[model samples]
Target: MTALHELTAEAAIRAIEAGETSSLELVDAALERVTSDPWHAFLAVDEDGARERARAIDANGERPPLAGIPVAIKDALSTRDLTTTAGSRILEGFRPVYTATCVERLERAGGIIVGKTNMDEFAMGSSTENSAYGPTRNPWALDRVPGGSSGGAAACVAARQVPLSLGSDTGGSIRQPAALCGCVGIKPTYGAVSRSGLIAFASSLDQVGPLARTVRDAALTLQAIVGRDPLDTTSLEWREPIELPAGERLDGLRVGIISELNGEGIEASVRGAVDSAAATVESLGGAVEQVSLPSVEHSLSTYYLIAPAECSANLARFDGIRYGRAAEGADSLLEHYERTRDEGFGSEVKRRIMLGTFALASGYYDAYYLRAQKVRTLVVEDFARAFERVDVLMSPTSPTTAFPLGERTDDPLSMYLSDVCTIPMSLAGLPALSIPCGFADGLPIGLQLAGPAYSENRLLGVAHALEQALALDQAPPEPA
Candidate 1:
C-alpha cells in the first residue's frame, strides 16, 4: 500500500473525500517527511498549525476541492505569522502580518500549509546554493542541485514531502528547478496569477506558479489560485476557472520545436530525450516542425540586464531601517545602510544589485537598460510571429539534467546558462510548463511546452497528451 505522503494532490483529495483517510493522517505523514528531510527542503514546518487546520477540516465535515492536501510554499510567499525569509539572512526570522494573496487562496481552498520551503536568496540564483540558510539537494542524487530560485519547492515535491507547492518564477525559477528535480512545474501566463504579497524578484518578470507531480494536479492548483485581484494591477480578469481537457489526443495540435534551443550547448542525452518527446507528440497525431525565433539568442543578455535592474529597485527597501537585519552600532545612517546590506545579502545578490545599479545609472541607462527593453520587445514579437505559425512550442527545459551542487558555484556565467532555454518565454510573458520526458544517467530531463499569453489551457492540454503517451515515471529514487 502506498503511504499517504506519496499520494498526488488529486488522489489525496479523492481519498479524503471518500473518508478512506483523515486530514490528520495526511498532515502527520507529511510532518514525518519534513522531520526526516535530508535535502534541507524546509526552512520551517508548522506542525501544530497544520494539525489544528486538519482537525478543523475533519470536524467540520468539509470536502473542499483540496481539503487537507499538504502543500509546501516557497519561502518567498508571505504566510501570515510564518517566517518568510526569501532564503536571505536579511529577512531571517521576520514574519509577515498579512498572507500573500495566492497563499491565502490556497488555504481557503483547503490546502494545508505544511511549511515554508527553501529558495535562492531573494530569488536571484539559478542554483539554490545561493540560499543564505544553505542549498537544497536534489532528491535524484544527493550531491546534485535541484535548480532555483524555487529549488526547495521543487525538491520538496520530488522527495514526496508534499503533493503540491507554490514557486515564483523570475526567468525560469520555477520550471528550471522543476526540470532538475524531476517533476511537473508550470509558470502561468504573466498576470494570470496575482503577484500581491509575493516577494518581488523582478516586478515585470516574476509570477507565482505551481509545481506538482502531474499536469492535472498542476491544473487543479492553478484553477484554485488564478483570477483577478484588485491588489495587483497587473492581474488579469478571468471569471471561469482553468479546466484541464480530458483525453490524450492531439489530432489538430501543431507543435513547433524551437530551433535555437537545440544544438551546440545542449547535451546529447538531453537532446535525445527531447527528440523522444517530440516523437511522442507526433505519435499523438500532432504536426511537428522546426521554428526559428532569432531574438531568443539574445534573451540571456536581455534578461540579465532587465531582471537585475528591477531587482535593484525592488530590493532597495530592505536597507535595514524598515525591517530585516539592522546594524547594531552604526553611528551614521549611511554607515547603517552599508553595514546592514553588507551583512544581510549573499554574494550573488550583491553582484546582481551592483550590476543593476550600474545599468540603471544615468550615464549608462540608455546603452544598457533601454537597449535591453527594445530587444525584449523584439523577443516578444518573435514569439508572436511563431505563434501565428504554430500552436505551441517545445524544447528541453534545461540543456542538461541536475548537476552536482558545487559544480557551477564558482562560475556564475555557467550557472546562468542553465536557464537560457526557459528565459525567452519569460521575456515574452507567455505560459509554459515543464514535465519529465525521460532520464539520462539516472537523472530526469524536462520537456518544456510554451504557448501565447493566456493559452495555458492549450499548453496544458498538449502537455497532458504527451505526458500520457510518453508515460515517463519520474519518481526519484529514495533519498540516501
Candidate 2:
C-alpha cells in the first residue's frame, strides 16, 4: 500500500471526502515525514496547530473541497502567528499579526497549513544554499540542489512530505526549483494571486503560486488562493471559473518554441527533451513552430538590473529597528544599522542590495536602471508580438538538470544564468509553469509552458494535455 504521505493532494482530498481517511491521519502522516526530514525543507513545523486544525476538519459535518489536505507554505509569506523568516535571520522569530491574503484564502478554502518551508534569504539566491537555515537537498539525489529561492517548497512536494505547497516566484524562484525537483510549479499571471503579506524580494516581480505532484492539484490550490484582493491594488479579479480540463487532445492549438530560450546554453539532453515534446505537441494536432523573441537575449542583463533595483528599495525597510533583530553593542545609529543588516542578512542579500544601490545611484541610474527598463519594454513588446502569432510558447524550464549543491554558490554569474529561460515571462507578468517531461542522467528535466497575460486557463489546459500524452510519472525516487 502507498503511504498516506505519498499520496497526491487530489487523492488525499478524495480519500477524506469518501471517509476512507481522516484529516488527522493525513496531517499526522505529513508531520511525521517533515519531522524526520533530511532535506531541511522546512523552517518551522506547526505540529500542534496542524493537528488541531485537522481534528476540526475531521469533526465538521460538511467537509470542504480541501478539508483534509495538508499543504506547506514558503517561509517568505506572513502567516499570522507562524514564524515567517523569509529564509533570513534578519527577521528571525518575527510573526505577522496578519496573514498574507493568499494564505488566508487557502485556509478559507479548507487547506491546512502544515509548516513553513525554507528558502533563499530574502529570496535573493538561485539555490537554497543561501538559506540561513541551510540548503534543502534534492530528494532525487541527496548531493544535488533542488534549485531555489523556493527550494524547500519544491523539495517538500518532490519528496512527498506533502502534495502541494505555496511558494513565491520572482525571477524564476518557483519554476526553476520545481523543475530541478521534478514537480509541477506555477508562477501565476502577476496579480492573479495577491502579494499583500508576502515579504518583498522585488515587489513588481514577486507573485505567489503553487508546487504540486500533479497539474490538477496545483490548479486546485491556485483556484483557492487567486482572486481580487483590495489590499493589493495591482491584483486583478479572476472573474472566470478555474477549470482543469482532462486528457491528451490539444487539437487546433498553436505552440511556439521560443528560439532564444531553446538555443545556445541549454544542455543537449534538455534541448532534446524539448524537441521531443514539440513533436508530441505536433502529434496532438497542434501547430509547432520556432518563434524568435530577440529582446529576450538581454533577459539576464535586464532582470539583474530591474530585480535588484526593486529588491534594494523593497528591502530598505528591514533595518532591524523597525523589523527583524538589531545587533547588540552599537554606539552610533549608523553603526547600529550597519551591524544589524550585516549580522541579519545573508551574503547574497547584501550583494544584490549593493548591486542595486550602484545601479540606482545618482549618476548611473540612466546608464543602468533606465536602460534596463527600456530593454524591459522591448522584451514585453517581443512577447506581445509573438503571442499575436502563437497561442502558447514552450522551452526547457532550466538550461540544465539539477547540479550538485555548492557547484555555483561562489560563482554568482553561473547561478544567475540559471534563470535566463524563466525570467522573460516573469518580467512580462505572464503565467507559466514547469512540468516533468523526461529524465537525463537519472535526474528530472522540466519542460516549461507559458502563455499571454490572463491566459492561465489555456496554458494549463495545454500543459494538462501534454502531461497526459507524455504520461511521465512525476514522483521523485526514494533516497538511496
Candidate 3:
C-alpha cells in the first residue's frame, strides 16, 4: 500500500471519499514525517491541532476536496492563532487575529494545517539563507540551498512531507524554490489570490500560490484559495475556477521560448532540458518557436528597486511602536526605533530596506524608484507582445541548479541573478509554473511555463502534458 504521506492531495481526497483512508490516519503520517525532517522545512508543526482537525473531518459525513490532506502554510501568511513570523525574529511570538483569506478558504475546503514553513525574512533573498530560522537545505542535495523566500514550502513538498503547501512569490520566490527542490510550483496571476492577512513583502509583486508534487495537486490547492475577496482591494475575480486537465498531449498549442531568458547566464543542462521540453511539446503536436522579450535584460535591476521600494512602505508598519518586538533602554524615541529594527530584521532585509529608503528619498525618487516602475511597465509590455505570438512561453526557472548552501550568501549580486529567468513573469503578473524537467549531477532542473494573465488553466494543461512526457522519478533521499 502506498504510504499516506506519499499520496498526492488528489489521491488522498479520492481515498477519503471512497472510505479507504481516515483523515486521522493521513494526518498522523504527515505529522510523523514533518517532525522528522532534518531539512528544517517547517518552523512550526501543529501536531495536536492537525490531529484534531483530521478527527473532525473523519467524523463528518461529507468529504471536502482536500479533506484529510495536510498542508504547510508559508510562514509569510497569517494563520489566526498560529505563529505568523514571516520568518523574521522581529515578529517572533506574534500571531494574527485573523487568518489570511486564502488560508481561510483552504481550511474551508477541508485541508488540515500541518505547520508554517520557513522563508527568507521579508521575502528579500534568493537562497533561503536569509531566513532568520536558518536556510532550508535542498532535498536533492542536502548541502545545497532549496531556493528562497518560499524555500521551506517547496522543500516540504519535495521531501514528500505534505501533498501541498502555500507559498508567496515575489520575484520567483515560489517558482525558483520549486525548481531547486524538484516540486511543482504555481504563481497565479497577481490578483488571482487574495492577499489579505498575508504579511506584506512587496504588495504589488507578491502573490500567493501553491506547491505540490504533481500538476493536478497544485491545481487543486490553487483553486480552493482563489477568487475575489472583499478584504483585498487588489483581488480580482478569477476568469473561472481552475479545473485540472488530464490530457497527455498539447495538440496545436503554441509555445514560445523566451529568447532573453534562455541564452545568457543559464546553465548548460538547464538550457538543454528547456530545449528538450520544447521538442517534447512539438512531439505532442504543439508548435514551438523562439520569441523575444528584449526588455527582460533589465528585469533583475527593475525588480530590486521596485520590490524593495514597496517593502519599505509596507514594512514601515513594523515600527517599534505598534507591535511584535520592541527595544528598550534607548536615550531617545528615534534611537529606540532604530535599535528595534536593527536588532529585529536580518541583514538582507535591512539591505533592501536601505536601498528602498534611498530610492524613495527626495533626491533619488525620480532617478531610481520611478524609473524602475516605468521599466517594470516595459517588462509587462514585453510579455504582452510575446504572448500575442504564442499561447505559452518556456524558460529555465533558474540560471543554475541548486548551489552549495552559503555559496552566494556573501555575494548578494550573484544571489539575485538566481531569479533572472523567473522574475520577468512576476513583473508581468502572469501565471507561471516550474515543473521538474531533468537533472544535472543528480540535482533537479526545472522548466518554467508561463502564459498571459488569467491563463492558468491553459498553462496548467500544457505543463501537465510535459510532466507526463518527462516522467521523472524525482523522490528525494531519505533522511539518514
Candidate 4:
C-alpha cells in the first residue's frame, strides 16, 4: 500500500477514484501526522470538520479536482469556522463571518482544509518569530528560521504534515519561505488571486498563493484559485482556467537573469545554486541572458514606503472601535482605540504602523507616499520592458538561506534586505515561483522564476521544466 502521507493531491485523487484507498484513510493518516508530531505549523486543527468533509466526499462520489486531499490554509486568510489569527493576539478568537474566496475555491475543487497554519504577525515580518504564538522552525533544520510570513504554511508542506498549503506573499513571504523550507511556492500576479478575505498587510501587494512540494501541485492549486471576484475589484480577469504544459521543455526558451539581483547582496552558496540552476536551463537548450532593471536598486526602499503607507490605511480598520481586540478598561473612545491597538499589536507591527502613518501623515504624504507610488510605477515599467526581451526573469529567492531564529530580528534593515529580490515582482504584479534548486550548508535554497502579469501558466511551465532538469526536490535533512 502507498503511504497516504506521501501522495500528492493529484495522486490521492486518482487513488481514491480507483478505489485503491478511501478518503477516510487519507484524512486519518494526515491527522495522525499532525497530532503525533508537533510541527508547530498549524495554529488551529480542524480535525473534526476535516474528517466530516472527507467522509462526505467519500460517500457522495462528487469529486472535486483535489478530492479527498488534505491541505493547510494560512492563518492570514479568513475561514468562517476556523480562527483566523494572523499569528497575533489581537485576533486570537476571531472567526470570519465568511470564508475567503480562495479557500472557498479550494473546497470547490475537492481540497480539504486540514488546519489554519501560523504566520508572522499581520504578515509583517520575514521570520515567524513575529508570531505572537511563537516561531515556526524550519522543517529541514529545526535550529534555522523558516522564512515568513508564510513560514508555517511552507513548513507544513515541507515537513509532509500537509501535502499542500496556502500562503500570502506581500514581499517574498511565500516564495522565500518555500525556498528555505524546500517546497515550491507560487505568488501569482497581484490581483490574480482574490484578496477579499485576506487580512491586509499591503493591500496592493498582498497576494495569496500555493505552497507545495512540486511545481505541478502549485500549478494545480493556482488553477483552482485564480479568477476574477466581485468581492475584490482589483482581482484578475482570467476567464479561462490556467492549463499547464503537460510535458514542457526549456528548448528555445529565453530566460533572463537580473544582473542586479546577483553579486554583493547574495551569499556565495546561494549565488552558486542559482548559477547551477541557470546551467541546467542552458543544458536544456534555453538561452540565458543578463538583464538589467536599474530601478530595482531602489525597490526595497520603495517597497518599505509604499507597503507601509498602505498598511497604515488598511490596518486602521482594526482600531478597537469595531474589529479585532479591544482594550478592556478605557473610559474614553479615543483612549479605547489607542490602548487596544498599542496593546494588541506586536512591536514590529507597531513599528511599521508608525512608519507608515508618518509617511502618509498630512505633511509627508506627498513627499513620501506619493513619491513612492511613482517609483513603483517606474519599477513595474522596468520589468515590463525586460519581459519584452525575455520570456521569464530568474533570481535567487533570497540573498541568503535560512538564518538562525533570532539572527536578524534586532536589525530591521538587515531583515528588510532578505526580501529585496522579491519586492520588485510584487510591485510589478508579476507571477513568480520559487522551486528548490539547491541547498547551502544544510539549509535549502530556491531559484525564483517570474513572468509577466497573468502569466502564471507560463511561469509554472518554465518552473516545471527547470524542476525536471534540476530535480532538487529530494528528501530534506532531518530536523536538528
lDDT of all predictions = 0.92, 0.91, 0.91, 0.89
Give lDDT tens digits, candidate 3, residues 65-110: 7877899999999988888888898999887888999998999999
Candidate 1 residues lying further than 4 Å off, grouped into runs, are: none
Better candidate number, 3 or 4, judged by TM-score: 3
Superposed model 3: Cα runs more than 4 Å off = none
Q: Per-residue lDDT tens digits of candidate 4, residues 386-427?
A: 989999999999999999989999999998988989999999
Which of the two candidates, 1 or 3, achieves a greater lDDT against the reference?
Answer: 1
The weakest ten consecutive residues by lDDT in model 2 span 471-480
Q: Give me the runs in candidate 4 sitting further than 4 Å from their true place.
A: 477-480
Candidate 1 Cα lDDT to native: 0.92
TM-score result, candidate 3: 0.99
Residue 404, model 4: Cα distance from true site in angstroms: 0.4
lDDT of 4 at 322: 59
- lDDT by residue for model 2 (36-148), tens: 88889999999999999999988875666677789999999999899989998988899888999999999988888999999999888778999988999998899999999
lDDT string, candidate 1, 1-480, tens digits: 578988998888888887799899999999999988998999999999999999999999867778889999999999999889999999989999899999988998999998999999999987799999999999999899999999999999999999999999989999999999889999999999999999998999999999999899999899889989999999999665699757789988899999999888999999999998988888888999999999999999999999999999999999887678887899999999999999999999999999999999999999999999999999999999999999999999999899998999899999999999999999999999999999999899999999998888888888788788888755788865
For candidate 2, the per-residue lDDT at 409 reads: 95
Candidate 2, residue 380: how far the Cα is off, in Å: 0.4
Q: Judging by lDDT against the true structure, name the best candidate.
A: 1
Better of 1 and 4 by lDDT: 1
